[model samples]
Target: MHLIYLDEAGNSGTNLDDPHQPIHTVCGVIVKDSQWLPIETQIDALIAHLVPRVADREGFEFHNSDIFQGHGFFKGWPWPTRVDALERLLDIIVTNKLPIVWGAVDKQKHKAKYVYPAAPHDMAFLLCAERAERWFKNHAKDDVGMFIADDTKAKSDMKKSFKEYRKTIALGNRKECLEHIIDTIHFADSRETFGISFRMRLTISSSGILWAPLELSPFLSELNGMYMQEGCFRKKGAAK
Candidate 1:
């Protein structure tokens, strides 16, 4: 089975007024069961490389906000050092050829466009889930897929949304069934799950690309290679 580990960034629930987080993004990294261990090992090694002095690396979490802002475990690290660490993490995904599936929503636009807009978290989850189902159907036809999201304050609401998605066609011009994805989404603590941590970094980096493209273009260019283009649920005539 393929496991799609998930994480999100810029989540403000139903409140679309947060100026700092004008968009909400949900990202998932697809890794086959057989490939998960190798990815986890590389992530562990990177953590060791980041903090060699710590004897037990079990608690080290790869949070992009902290890593980017030089906070938490990444505090006191130089800018170049932090950037290098993030790049190295990205390298693991590149080397593994993992397929990244993500969904992002511009809060203001979505709110204005709908009579009663779905919360950004809900909309992003559906989009991400749609592509994840597409991935299993197109790329891994013989295998089933599972979803695991990092535990967040939006867990209860997201769980409700997930159930509805599994039961009906998503709101779109075409039918988007999430049947290929088996079971309910398992919510795990990011600090304990390497895959979730990997996902956390990806979501943040992707959100950065959306909101601050000029500053994150280099990372964006590097990340483009990992997206599952064929699995993307783009509208007709949408730019690739």
Candidate 2:
């Protein structure tokens, strides 16, 4: 059996009037039944390495809860530290060869259209759904289920959108098709929320990795080019 949990990092909407910055990312991780404990242990070790004293002081053991809370140590740290932590988390995901998926949406396109922009949360969920579909298609032999944290209200909204999306894809009222998709889709608030009877274990990764490489290289380069050419963010009274 396969279990996948969804999480996201980064803000979707930046200061609107600022033209120089416009990128939103959605990241996801997928794991099989056997990998849950090893992944969790690795994450705990990484956190301890990053901030041993914080864990010792608080007597708060790391669990699924800490992923969304910034894990306590990263709250007000400098940008460099935050970036480093994000990189380390990404390294863990890549090292494990876990299924990681992400999408970077161009903010300028929505702004130009002047429509109510899709929230970052919505985009993240859509990305998750897309990745889940891909995984399902690729692994025909496996029984797949989705377990997502109650990290944000966006997740609940995404569940609704995903149902609609499935309907569109199924395109008919056949019971067999609906049952097939329903068997594949399962939502849980957290690992604990779902009993351990399910064969699969759980894994978590930072969502920030979705944007790190892109922001560090090509995406930033393109943005810089646009800024240099038009002086967009530097314009008099411009907002960022």
Candidate 3:
């Protein structure tokens, strides 16, 4: 069995047209349940290793956005120092040999199509979850996995979208992917959990893949062909 940490980056909410955040990324960090303890311990010990906040608070959360934006515990840190800490975190992920599956959408490109079951973020979640399900089923038939995500205030719609997928997966009309995931997802507050804080340790790879929609990025023309060949990376109903 495995426990997968699921989260997203570059969320534009309902504004897929937002110029700044043209992309929405969803990541699944798949770790064997057996090794979760040691991996969590190693990452938690580093909370005090990097730049720390001096306020009278109990502690701080390690968020990718806050670190990149020089806020919270990452505030007042030199650029290189922050970069180094992030690299060290990535090293932890690589050293552990974690397998990650991710999906991202160039929102602007997708928005142009103007057809989808839900918003971009919800769509991204469903699409990404399907890939994770495929990975588990494809590898070992007996393997099972559950999802844990950072608890966010506005996740009702996303939850509904996932439920819809699971509800209809057996109808044959929804063959784009199947849902072998555990029935309900678990959530943790990032402020209280090391796993959620490190959930996106593998976003860099997904970002590289979803940097720009294939249609708009001339450089990724051939790479887009490879994605089509794989088929699972495509949006629902898009695979031929």
> lDDT by residue for model 2 over 136-203, one digit each (tens)?
66553356556444345455566676676555443135221221234323445443432221111122
Over 4 Å off, model 1: 56-58, 200-220, 224-240
lDDT of 1 at 138: 77
Better by TM-score, candidate 3 or 1: 1
TM-score of each: 0.85, 0.54, 0.75
lDDT of 3 by residue, 7-122 (tens): 88778687877776666778777778788899878776665566344453366676766666788767887766766666566566667766677767777667776676247787
* Residue 5 lDDT (model 1): 93
TM-score of 2: 0.54
How many residue pairs of model 1 clash at the backbone?
A: 0
Best by TM-score: 1
What lDDT does the true structure give each of the candidates?
A: 0.75, 0.45, 0.64
* Superposed Cα deviation of residue 217, candidate 2 (Å): 9.1
In model 3, which residue pairs have backbone atoms overlapping below 3 Å?
A: none
Residue-level error in angstroms, candidate 2, position 59: 8.3
What RMSD value applies to candidate 2?
A: 10.7
